[model samples]
Target: MRADARKNHDHLLAVAGTAIAEQGVDVSLRDVARRADVGLATLLRHFPTREALLDALLRTRFDELTARAGELETSSPSEDALVSWLRDCVACAHEYRGVTALMAAALEDAESALHASCVAMRAAGARLLTRAQAAGTARTDIDGTDLFALVAALAWLSDQTSLAPRADHLFDVVAGAILTSAGNSATGTTAPRPRP
Candidate 1:
């Protein structure tokens, strides 16, 4: 890609990502083109179809998160590291609200975002979980898949409720379930923490 073409491509990707994140994957390509200050022909030239656009959108974000997780992969306390990464993931979740759904929809079109995103997130998450488990901070029984499932579920749930402060509580209640029995024993209760 030439410098000018590369700039246009990057602009389109940014606009498309913002549009999809704000409105959803269902947002039309015209809107993306408008936001990018490009013509529909240009948009289509870069992204042949809706699936192509969404795949690129998701792949960009997945790659970003993978890089972030890699940079943060240190020998820190497992629980702390896991918590840090989860916070980062939550931020990403908020940044791209319907990203999970977009990827799901993309798969129905036989797109590659699903596999690529899954592989990237899985590898990053595995490293975090392994460190957490090693530090005896996370439950040994829970693996990367379990944690990712919990995070995805929580991300979906969080997106549903726009209750601001309540979002953190919602995530904790759902994610806390996987903590070891001795983990939150100090709290002296297995019941769901009452919502704020």
Candidate 2:
């Protein structure tokens, strides 16, 4: 793509991503185009279908998130890094209210881009888990699948009006199960739980 075209594409994706997060999957191409200050024809040229557009935006978000997790993977205190990544993941998940719904709808259709992105995300997440587990701070029983479920729940809670503000509480509850530091329990702060 030309430089201007690429800029337009990036701008459209950013606008659409935020719109979808705030307005749910029903947001119109017109709104995205308007936010990006681009014409409808340009938006259509970039994304032929709403589902296709959503899939692209979802992948883009996941890609950025994966990079962020990877960047922090080697940080000291593996447990902190993992928990931090989990918190960030929830933020990324909430960027769109019905993101999980969109993924579900698209995943049902085999050979879809959504399916491909899901696979990629799973692998990336697993790698992070492996690193944390290697550091002997994460529970052996808990795997990437478990983490995925946690993120799903967090995202769902984030989409809810009543649960949104307390979303961090939900994450704290889940993190309480994973972090470990019984020795520092004296401080009375929510210390990490035992890994074993």
Best by TM-score: 2
Q: Give a tens-digit lDDT track for model 2, residues 33-149.
A: 898887889899999888779877888777777776777776545666677777777887787877776665554567777877665565666777777667665655777777877
Stretch of 10 with least lDDT, candidate 2: 180-189
For all candidates in order, the CA lDDT equals 0.68, 0.73
Clashes of each: 0, 5
40-107 in candidate 1: lDDT tens per residue? 99999999998788777777677777777776776445555566677667666666777665544443
Listed in order, each prediction's TM-score against the native is 0.79, 0.82
